[model samples]
Structure formats: structure tokens, C-alpha cells
Target chain A: MENSLITADAVEISEFPHLAQKYSVRGVPKTVINEEYVIEGSGPESMLLSTILEAVEKTGSG
Target chain B: MSFIKDADRPAVKERLRDMRSDVTLSYFTQDVECDFCRETRELLEELSSIEEKIRIEVYDFKTDQEQVRSYRIDKIPATVVSNGGASGIRFYGIPAGYEFSSLLDAILMVSRNESGLSDETRKALQDIKVPVHLQVFTTPT
Candidate 1:
């Protein structure tokens, strides 16, 4: 819902190195919070919010 | 997607003229295999031409082992967003569809060194002193 109207080119991720193996970046849009919390595949609104909160909680800062 | 066009170039150039801050769009692509590499490179170059403070740098994904290691990237078709002098934020897929806001947000955030997040949100993010990496992945839905 946040991104609509605009083309896909603006938000595309096109640069990554192979060492991400350590990060285990398995899927696209995989958000690792402060290298501490790992939010898996993108989920629906409710699930996404929960994941964001979980990351924040785990970080114990933001 | 082709900001390199004749008509649109002037507009972007005009806007970027007065803009303050140095931004770099680091484009990492492979030579022969990837599908979107060409298009992404084109877009970065075009965008760079539009903005004075913005510059685009392209690197080989497999061959540039040094850059790959330094940038901490593990995928192609990604972008490492740099603001002022700091370079680290990355996107692993096309930043479009619903993620455009995030892209523009990154630009403005880098330009201003502020996220442009709401007051409450700003308060929330300001406490970040340690390395804070936030990744959000999604399809163009």
C-alpha cells in the first residue's frame, strides 16, 4: 500500500556481493536489523508490523 | 525507467542544481548473465546526469572481489546508497512498485542526513548509534 503509482525501477535492489552467505540472505527484501534480528520473507500488513516490532524489541534500542 | 531521455534530463538537472549534499548510487552488475543489469545501469547513469551532487558508479559483481567484500553485498541488481560520505545501505532487488517511497526516502534521508520520518518516528530512530541495518523485502504489489 505504501508504494503504488511509481515504477519498480526506483526501489529495485541491483547490487550485492557473494559474502552475503554469512548473512544468509536467502530471499529478496530480507531485512536484518542491526545484524541482530532477521525478518524473513515479506508478509502481509499485520505480520510485517509484528516483524518490525520484533526487530525493535530484540535490538532493545530502536 | 530511462531517466537518460532528452526531455526529462533537464527537469532533474534543474532540481538537483540547488540541492545540497553529495549522493552516490553504486550500481553493481555482472557482464553477461544478469537480465536487469543493463537497465539498472542505464537508470543510474541517467539519474546521475540529472543531479549535480549525485554520481553513479558501476562495478562488476563477480570480478570486483574487493568491492564486493567492502560493500558487504551478496546479490546482484542491488544498490548501495551513499549519503554525504557514508555508504552502506543496500537494496537487493528492483526498488520499485511499492518500495519507491523507500528509495526516495533513502535519497532524501541521505541528502539531509535525516530520515524525514515523522517527529515520533524520528525520536524512535535517533537512538541508533551502533550499526543499525534495517532491510525490508517485498514484491511490486
Candidate 2:
């Protein structure tokens, strides 16, 4: 599944206040992809996959 | 003082029984200023005790320079789940409440050595040549 290419971290904002501030994590389940694209809430698997692909495309092109 | 309640042990054990391979939980923590470090470590220990295939490796965030660098850990109370290989699954805080499911899911996925993604998603992922890091910020609430 090419698992090695994708890294996922579930961060608890309250524990790391600094990270929450840096990422502007004011809500729960805020997903930040590659420090670029930000997903504000949880969604279906398809949505996450698309976000990942979008981030990858942006990184690849830029 | 156990983070995992005794009543929940059997269910947790049953879930972990599906593991096909050994999964290592590499936890990094410092002695000071880390609020959930102790609880996180205890939770991992209790979880590992439930299944023989799951192992917990503790490292100091400030002292374990090599591990910190290799894992690319920049924060305290981080747990990296792997099956003796880089799986790129990590938790950056105490995986409590609903988020605990995510930790278990990662462990099971690593043990199975599969992402459980759909064929189409897997195909799409093939085009990803660069590393994609996903930071899902959540609260225990």
C-alpha cells in the first residue's frame, strides 16, 4: 500500500500548546498535510486521500 | 494508577490478538515539562502487556539524540508505531479518549504490514514520490 511514503501523526493539541499555536489548531481533528494544506475537520477516507494527493501534487510541482 | 482499567483489559487483548506480526511502540519523552509523558508510557506498557506481539521502547527526548534524530521527533510525548520497519505512523500526545482508537488502528495496521487503503487509493498513492506528512491535531475531548 506504499505505507512508507505516507506518515500520519495524531497530535493532541492540549498536550503540546506550542504545536497547537504553530498550527493554529483551534478545533479538533485539524489535519495539516506536509505543513501546507490544512483540513479543518475529519471526513471520509476519500476526502483525506484527495487532500494527500493534492498536497503531493503541490509539492511535486512547486 | 493503571491508565487502562482492569475491566477493559480483556476487550483490548481480544482486539490485539488479530496482530500478525510484532509491533514496536517507540515512545519519546523528557523528564521535565512533559505533562502526559508518564501516563502515555503507562498506557503503552499496559497495552503491550495485553499482547505479546506489541513491544514498547522508551527513549528520552533530550538524551536519546540518535533515536530522536532518526525518528525526526521534534516534540515531547511522541509515540512512533512500527513493525520493525518505517511505517510513518506516530502519535504526538497521549492517545486517550476517542483518539485511542487511532493508536490501536495504527498498531494493527503496522502488524499487518498493510495500509488497508482501497485499490484505487493505493494506485493514486503510487504517484506520490515525495514524503507526505499528515498531522492530525486533536483534543482528548
Candidate 3:
């Protein structure tokens, strides 16, 4: 979400080992939302959106 | 040789035609050690040539200290897609396969300077006061 407070980055696991280990990314196509929510696989746009929304809401940050 | 296939040019051009502003991709790489640096640069070059509003600026990761610091790029084959300014959108590898579409989407978002988020999502984001770093990791395959 560029217009919002959320910033997005597509990180290559091989290049950034620290991040990969910090998030425990053992597989490809893992999406770490806000460093709090993890979506391990690919899905529809709605699914990704809802995943972020749910995670943020649960954490009471957004 | 061109990295983008000839068949892909028409559709790629059409998608980038709607860009409202000029988008510059700041790419950082080191020649000696990076595996995907050459390919990533070539891909960005080919993609940028497909649209007038798109531009690519290549930088040496070891020598371009100012650019690396300004963009906060900590890895090789890193690309920062920005339109008006830095939008915090980055790609840490070659945008190949399905990830190519992700780069296109990022370019569109940067050109429009809008997230295209829903009203509900926007409202929720409005409540967030701190910075949120959302990282999506994926392989080229």
C-alpha cells in the first residue's frame, strides 16, 4: 500500500539471509506482512488483502 | 540479446501506456559477486525501453555510496521503482516469470502515486501511526 503507511518490498532470500532467517522463510513465495503476519504461499489478491487486514486487526495496530 | 521476448512487447507496452508520471528504476549491483546483477539490469533496460515514462538508472553497489545510502539498499540486484519520489518499493532479485507482473504493478502504483487500496483498507491504514515494512519473498521460478 504505497499511499498508506504500509511499505512493500520483494526480497530475494539468497541475497538477504538475515531477513530470511528472521522471518523463517524456508520456501519460496512467502509473504511477510508487517513482519507480524506470514502467508506461506501464493493466492488470490483478496486472500492476500484479507490476510493483512486480519493480522493487523488482531494485533490492534491498524 | 534482449531479455524480453518480442511477443511480450505489445502487451507490456499496453500495460505501461496508462502510466501518468515518469517512473525511474534505481538499480544497484556489483559486477564481481552478484549472480543476477547482469540479468536484472538487462531486464530493467528492456522493460524501460518499452515505455517512454519509464527510465532505468544503474549504480555500482560498491562505489555509489550516496545512492546506496539514500535508497537504503542493502543487497545486490536491488531495484527501487519510484515515480515522483521513493515509494519504498523494492525488488531484490530479477523480476522474472510471475514476478515480472509484480514489477509492472509496482510501476503502475508508483506512476499513479496511489495504492489502489479499497476504502476499508485505506481507513484501516489511516489509523496506523508507525511505519509498516511489508516484505514479500519469492524465487524467480
lDDT of 1 by residue, B48-96 (tens): 6666677778889899889788776667787777764544566566655
Candidate 3: segments with Cα more than 4 A from true spot: A1-5, A14-22, A34-36, A43-62, B31-33
Best-to-worst order by DockQ is 2, 3, 1
> What TM-score number comes out for model 1?
0.62
Model 1, span A1-62: residue lDDT tens: 11111111222333333334556765666655545666676655555445545665665554
Which residues of candidate 2, in runs, are more than 4 Å off? Answer: none
TM-score comparison, 1 vs 3, better candidate:
3
DockQ, in order, for the candidates? Answer: 0.18, 0.78, 0.52
Looking at model 1, residue B83 earns an lDDT score of 61
Comparing to the true complex, what docking class would candidate 1 get? incorrect
| Ranked by lDDT, top first | 2, 3, 1
Model 2 Cα lDDT, one tens digit per residue, B15-86:
777899999999999878488889999899999888889999999999999999988998879999988788
TM-score of chain B of each: 0.74, 0.95, 0.92
Candidate 3 CA-lDDT value? 0.81
Ten-residue region with minimum lDDT total, candidate 2 chain B:
B30-39
Would you list the C-alpha lDDT of every candidate in the order shown? 0.58, 0.87, 0.81
Per-model TM against the reference: 0.62, 0.94, 0.82
Cα lDDT of candidate 1 equals 0.58
Judging by DockQ against the true structure, name the best candidate: 2
